[model samples]
Target chain A: MEIRIGHLYPDLLNLYGDRGNIQCMVKRCQWRGIEASVTEYQLEDPIDFSGLDIILLGGGSDREQAIVCEKLKTIREDFKAYVEDMGVVLAVCGGYQLLGHYYDTDQGRIEGLSLADLYTEQGSPRLISNIIIENEDFEMPFVGFENHGGRTYTGDLKPLGKVLFGCGNNGKDKKEGILYRNIVGTYLHGPLLPKNPHLCDYLLKNALMRKYGQAELSPLEDREEKEANLYIRKRFLERQ
Target chain B: MKVRRLMAVWTAKIISAACRLSGRQGVTLAGKIALKIDPGILRDLSSQVREKIFVVCGTNGKTTTNNLLCSAVESEGKKVICNHTGSNMLSGVAAAFVLSAGISGRLDADYACIEIDEASTLRIFPHFKPDYMILTNLFRDQLDRYGEIDLTMKILSQAMAMAPEMKLILNGDDALSAYLAMESKNDFVTYGITEQVFHDQDSREIREGRFCKKCGAKLEYEFYHYSQLGRYRCPSCGFERPPIEYDAKNISMEHGLSFEVEGRSFHADYRGFYNIYNILAAYAGAREAGFALSRFSQVLESFNPQNGRMEQFSIDGTKIILNLAKNPAGFNQNISAVMEDPSEKDLIIVINDNAQDGTDISWLWDVDFERFLDPSVKSVTVSGIRCQDMRLRMKYVDIPSTLVEDVEKAIKDRIQHGCGNLYVLVNYTALYSTRNILAGMQER
Candidate 1:
């Protein structure tokens, strides 16, 4: 099967190894004899969701974020429609913040696409640590590193997972990420894919199913990926 | 006032002595204790040195540039007090001064060359006013620790404004450093590599400061030396690289670089294009300090990358090279340097997620490790607190688990397997500990 991944704002909203998610998806698909083509959509670039199978959005520095927020507003309508159609979308740290209604930073409030019924607010003391989340969708816990200042409030959407370790979504909520239909948004950016091959394959399977109505993905050897994931998960869990 | 200064000095000396007696490295401890005793210690000592003081700050090359400048001034028959160690914070700067301050509350030095951490720039300038400050280059370093490059630039601008008389020495080739010149109006003297240096394809992936700092338009690069450090100009708003004053030309970096500065040829003791920039920055700072241009030859010839940076070892006829790579840019440069040698080699990358090492290990994914998958690379072993993370990153690029191993066991096993050429790339917090282990193995 052929998978087309749209990497949104490849220039502006790129930070914290976010491209690794794209790399993980491509490598895993290629390993299973699937052709994965990535198309980078930068600021002001017109994005057509018709041909895209999966969309990946990463974070960036605050300066870059401001520039991206303006450009994201222009594509908010198209992006929201894509999400409403149950298009496979994975938004990370800064990218996740922008998918919400607004991100209230110390400087000012940045208007998000309001794609999901969510919003974020900046406060004192950033929440940063190795995060482990328990989700029923996967056999193993979702493990990743999170470094974000904005606390997100998920409105009318189910949380992606329950926090087993580290601060997720908000420090108070014991919940991590917001899942709207097939959309996944999280602050967990160990690029959120390389270490968690289960999540990587889940997203791939979901994308395949959404596009072709069936996904019986043949699992490749995941010995290395499993060991890496177990190593981080155990490290954080043992500390707590 | 004298009594307070003396108390701080005596406590620092006692702490230094006690630390040495206990076989511990108390480099920054004494400084921290001295500040606790007398917060004004830095101000008093710096006032004594006044215009003779030189402060160096940057994402990379501050240690190298500060050391080189210190050596250059000292070689010119002037006494210098500098933080030779990697302690570049306020306490370290204060400690250097307190340690230098004698019982008479006077520093017995002609000049003071101090390295200031870029984040601590605003805090350092209010206390210690240096007559000259050299910024090597700015890159996105330890994100959690220093926010962003723009924040760092803002801090630097505040620091520059506080020290209005300070002569700013900046890297013109670096768009970020050059952008600093536009932010603040100090007596700015720029230095850059005028000629084309070694080109590495890996740099294209790590281009930072690509957007125009002045206008949000994309920056047009004539050619990159490495990671946005090149001749770049904005097509919009007309912001461009300033004219280089202490320009280095006729560059060659096969073994080590040789470049001409003010019609005089000089050779840097260390290899790498970054080191060449470090040397040029030092050369410019020393000249601005009123040192003769010809006097830098001896210092340049004798200078070496201090500590475990580019330190080599030979254990049982097997050559092991240790280099410090704190960020993606440094790691990529080390990889490029290592890949230059066509001989068979194995890499052991040790990544520590300690407090000093910016506990967030996500930066590993930012490094272009796929470039090292050539036939010359026999194996790639991973180690330290975040070794598995490194291994997972390498795995995505198709490097098998059999090739990647744990640190301690891999070193012994690699040696046992008769691996002759080994390159050990270590990040910050794990540098000294890993070096000691390698040293112990070498002695055995």
Candidate 2:
């Protein structure tokens, strides 16, 4: 099955190796003899949300994030429709904050897409560190890095996981990321998917299941991924 | 005040000596301690400089450019105070001054060539204003420490405003650096390679300066040398590369590097193509400071920055090259330098997630490790704290890698059993430790 991945503002919203998520997804699909293609939708490019199996919105610098927030606002209805259709979407860091209600920064309040009932406020001393999360949906824990000044609150959405290590979403709340339908939005950006093969596969499975009604993906050699994931989990999680 | 300055210098000197006696580099620790003793130590010491002070700032090549500028000034029979170690922070800058000062806290140097960390420029500027600020190039480096490139530019712009009299020596090809020069309105001289040298497709993937800093428009590049450092212009607002005063023409990187800048032929036995900018930066800085360039080539010929920057080592008739590859841009350039060698080579990449190394190891994916799948690459070994992440990065590219937990052991294994030609690429925290390991093994 062919999976068309739509990368929103790949040029603007790329920071902290965010493209690695796209690479991880593409590589995983190719390894399983599945055709995967990535169509990068720039700021001016028209995005056909219906043709996409998976959509990735990565993080960017503050200036780039503001520019992308404006572009994302124009396509809010289309994106909301895509999410309602159960299309797989992975938004990270700044992108995750932009998908919410609004991000209150020192400069002023920047409006978000309001796809989810989430909002973020700028916090002092950025919550930056290696983050591990425990999700009941997966057998293994998710491992990634988190660096953000905005502390997000998942208003009514279910959290992706519990914070096993490091600050997640808001340090006050133990909730890490917002998980609504097939959408996964988080602050963990060690591009968040390469080491966490289970999550990568989960997103791929959701995308494939939506397109062809079945996702019997053959298991690929995940020795490296498993080792990398376990290394972080064992390092941070086992200590706690 | 004199007693306090004297105490700070002597205490720092004693601490530095004690650190050496205890077999520790103590590169920045003494500076940290000295600053604690006297907060005004940097200002007091730097104020005593007999001549001009040059400050080098940028993401990469700061240390090398600063050291080279020091050597270039020293070649003209002038005493130069420089932070030889790659310590570019405020404490390091203080240490450079404190350590260089005599026991009486008196600096007798003619020129002070200090490499100030871009993030620490504002802190460093309050102490002493540099006569010339040499910005080698601006690429995304250690995002955790420096925030974003915009933040860094903002910091630098504020720092430059503090010292309006300071001239700028910038890499013209870097649109980010060039734009900063244009915005600052400083008397700046740019040096850039007008020709396209690097054809690596991977280098083009990780450019941080794709958008125009002025108009927020997509930058139009005529050709990219590597990673946004090329002839670029913006369609909107008419922002473009400044006219290069020191244009490096007829560049050749076959045997080291050979290039001509302003009708003067210069060559260095440097490995990476990026060294041309470093050398050019130093040349432009030295010239701008009114230093004689008669012994410039001689300085370049003799300058071998042995602190893990293309530092060479020999063990048991095997040639080993150690270099620091901290960020994606640096690692990509490091990979290109490695690929330049056609000989069969064993590669050991040590990736640490230390606070200094930008705890986020995600930048590894931005580096094109798939290029390591060449026929000449015999074995690839991953080491350090984030070795598993490095191994996983390699695995996605279908390149099999061996994970060695210990960096020294990884180096030892490759030097003993693998091919005689070895290349060790390391990030910030791993550089010194791995260099020490390589040094110890070489002595054995």
Candidate 3:
């Protein structure tokens, strides 16, 4: 089966090796004998959400974010429609911030796509550290790096996980990321997949299910991925 | 002023001596003590110096470029005071001035070449008016500490506003670096590669400065030498790469680097365009300090970068090329430098997340490790605090992983079984610790 991944604002919103996530998804599917293609959608590119099985949005700098935010406002209707159709979307960091209602900043509030019932406020001293989180869907704690200045309130939506280590979503709450319908928005990006194979598989399964109506993915012996996850989990847990 | 200078000197000396007795390097400690004793020590001591002061800075290559400029100036038979230690902070700059001064706090030198950090520039430039300020290039580094790339530009621009009369030497190829000269009324000279030197297909892998500073339009590159640094022009606005005053023309990376600047051919042991920019910046900077190009070129022949910045060693008959990469630009350049060799070689990438190394490890994803999947690579070994993350990043590239618990053992394992050259790429803290471990092995 062919899986199409639309990488949103690859030129603008790729701050923290954001391309690594797209590459990780592509490679995992390729290893499983499935054809996966990535279509980079930059500014003004037609957002044909129907063709895309998964939409990956990475993070970028404030200047790039401002540019992408302006472009995003123009495609809010199309993006909302795509989300309504249960498209598997994974947005990270700055991308995660843009999926909310508005990103409040010192300069003013920047309008977001509002696909998820969330909002972010720019705060002093950014939250940056190695983070571990636990979700109902995964047995192991999801390990990744989180660096964001915007304090996001998930508001009623099911959170992707609880903050097991480091600050997530907001320092006040233990919750991290948002999992609304098929959309997954988080500040984590160890490319958010290579280390956390379970999460990668979860997204892949969602995408596969959306396309073929079934996703009985044969586990590709995640020996290395498992070892990597175990090592990180132990390191952070030991530090505590 | 003399008495305060003497007080600062004596206090720093005692602290430095105590640190030495305890078997610790007192370079940073001495500076800290000197600054504590007299907050105005750097300013007071620098003001008394009859010699010209040159402040070299950027995200990367500050050490090598600073050292190269110092060596070139020294070759002209002048006493030069430099912070040879890797401490480029405000305290480190103060320590260099305090320690170099006589007992009376009177500096006896013809030149003082100090490397300043980009963030520290705002603090240092306000008090110390440099005769020449050389900015190598700017890249997004240590987001936790330095914030964003634009923030760095803001800091450096504010710092430049203070040094209105200082001759600014900048890398014309870098948009952010060249942008410094935009508002500065100071006399400036630009150094850049006139043409593309490498044929690497993955040239524009990670562009740090893509938008035009003037118009916010996407900048067009004639060809990326690496990242957004190249001969570029903005289609929306007429902003383009300034005409380079000192151009690195014929660059051939055969064995080592051989390039020409203004018809003067110079050879350097350093490889890659980044190092070439360092050498070119130094050449231009040295000339600004009134040193002849011939003398600077002569000194560069014997100048080797210090403390594991492209330092090489041999262990058990295995050739090891070790270097430090604090950010993506440096790391990417080192990767490309290793890829220049088609012969099969074992690779070791060591990463650390120490506070000094910037606790954020997300930048590792920005490095194009997929290029390491070349058939010439025999093995890939990962080590350091974030080795698993490195391994995972490389896994996507389809390269098999060898996670050695100890960095020393990892290098040894590669040397023990490897048949060809071993390229060890380390970041920040790993660079020094791994080098110290392997340096001992090299001696035996």
Candidate 4:
């Protein structure tokens, strides 16, 4: 089954070469005989997200992110109905913040759709570092670099992850991402699936399951077991 | 909180030490973290060491100016401290300050000459307060990080506001630099070019910041030396490039190029007429730092891009030259430099879709590749992740391209065939990878 991924703001939210993340995702999927194509959307460009299977967003500067947030603000209703209802979203760094409730930047434009329970305020300080997030529910370590000013505190919803190594963010609270249903939004950067093979498999399985049901996933029985063992070992060691 | 800050500092030190010990990047990693801990930490740390600081800042010419200023200042045989690793961030400066500054907060060098990053300059300037700040031309660069021209100008304007007493060595050709020096209350120096090259005289490519910031009038450019720069005049307000203290006149691409400044003619040992703005700024900044004019002139004329800026190499009858062109102005300068050579030359340009290189490939549209329509260029090769983008650009351009493919094969194919004088333009991300790939091909 073909899994379509939308690389939102391929131009704007591409600071620190975040395109490599999308390339790696497509490359890995192609290697696994999975048909995955990244649909890039730019400024003022019309993109219908109704048929899309997955969405990916990257990090950029405060200003560029603000422009994208403003641009995305117009299509917030489309996002709520389609993105929140069905499709999966893998947001990294600035991308994750944007997919959630309001990003009030002190310098420029701010505000985003309240899809997730995360509030961000800019002005205080930027958290720039490589981090390891531990997800208790999920058996893997999520790794990514986050360069953002503002602390995020979840009001009601469960966090996507817990801090494993390094600073997960503003406080030792160990919250990293917000995962609900098929939608997975986090501070984990692209090449996100490179470390957490389970999450990648989970995303692929659900994407395939959503499209072709359990019958299509039967071919991956033995392959999944072997890969899962190898993935667990590496994930465990990276956390250590 | 203090513990977290200390951990950040120690974490940076460990990363830097490990990197250096493993024979990789020396102090850049440590520097990156120091700034994260506190943007003002470097300046505060520097105060412990009693030494007058000198800063070199600009878009295209900071690296060149930094190198030039270093040479002239070192001529007096003073122990000059600097971040030569090209990490101009507060972290890098802080790391440099820590490594070079004594226990008493006194620096080993008589003077500190530093290369400063544009965005970080706003935050770092107030604290460091350099004795002399060499203001280089502000060009459109890393749009993902620095934003537009005017945004960068605001940050720089803020920096200028903080450091009033600091001597400014300004680039007169740059509208932004010229405007900054003109508006500054500090003692300032202006250095620029007279008339040279096919500067934005009669051209069509996006010139960022086409409108005047002061009067909100349509700013017109008589010539664009490099993006939004060059001879500009406000249509409404009569603000122009203030009279330069030193200027380079006779600007030409022909053999034996020289520019006259302050009733004196300056010559370059290298083909540096196009970047005379960088040269003159370096000259003035170095002179302001107490280097003699004779010493400044002598050092600048001899010093060329040693750190992979415009390095020349030869392999298998092919003269492979590499030049850094990360932005529009830089791209124009490097491409124009290739066209300046009368002899036919093979060309290769590698563009990456990496985070460091600015993933937005749209910057390629502004690069005046049409300037290379001259007869001197024979075959052109474009490569990297964004090779197709460059290929499409070349296809649109009037220039012809022989090969456009992935970097490894295109470069090797050209090198194997015995091409005469191949000039490769690589951005920051693709430079080392391309260099290593070429090195591997040569070994085989």
TM-score of each: 0.95, 0.97, 0.96, 0.61
Sort order, DockQ high to low: 2, 1, 3, 4
Off-target runs (Cα >4 Å) in candidate 3 are: B1-7, B14-24, B199-204
Q: What DockQ score does model 1 reach against the true complex?
A: 0.73
Question: Could you tell which candidate, 2 or 3, scores higher by lDDT?
Answer: 2
DockQ, all candidates in order:
0.73, 0.83, 0.69, 0.03
Model with the higher TM-score, candidate 2 or 4: 2
lDDT: which candidate is best? 2
TM-score attained by model 4: 0.61
Ranking by TM-score: 2, 3, 1, 4
**RMSD in angstroms, all models?**
2.2, 1.5, 2.0, 10.9
For model 2, the docking class works out as high
Question: Residue by residue across A25-73, what tens digits does model 3's lDDT show?
Answer: 8888898898999898868678888899999988887667878888887
Residue-wise C-alpha lDDT for candidate 1, range B231-301, written one tens digit per residue: 98899889999999999988877667788889999876565668878888999999987889566777777
Clashing pairs in 3: A15-A59
lDDT of 4: 0.67
> If the candidates were sorted by their lDDT against the true structure, best first, what order would they fall in?
2, 3, 1, 4
> What are the chain A TM-scores of the candidates, in order?
0.97, 0.97, 0.97, 0.83
Ranked by DockQ, the better of candidates 2 and 4 is 2
Best by TM-score: 2
The CAPRI category of model 4 is incorrect
Q: Where does candidate 1 clash, by residue pair?
A: none
Clashing pairs in 2: none
Tell me the lDDT of candidate 3.
0.84
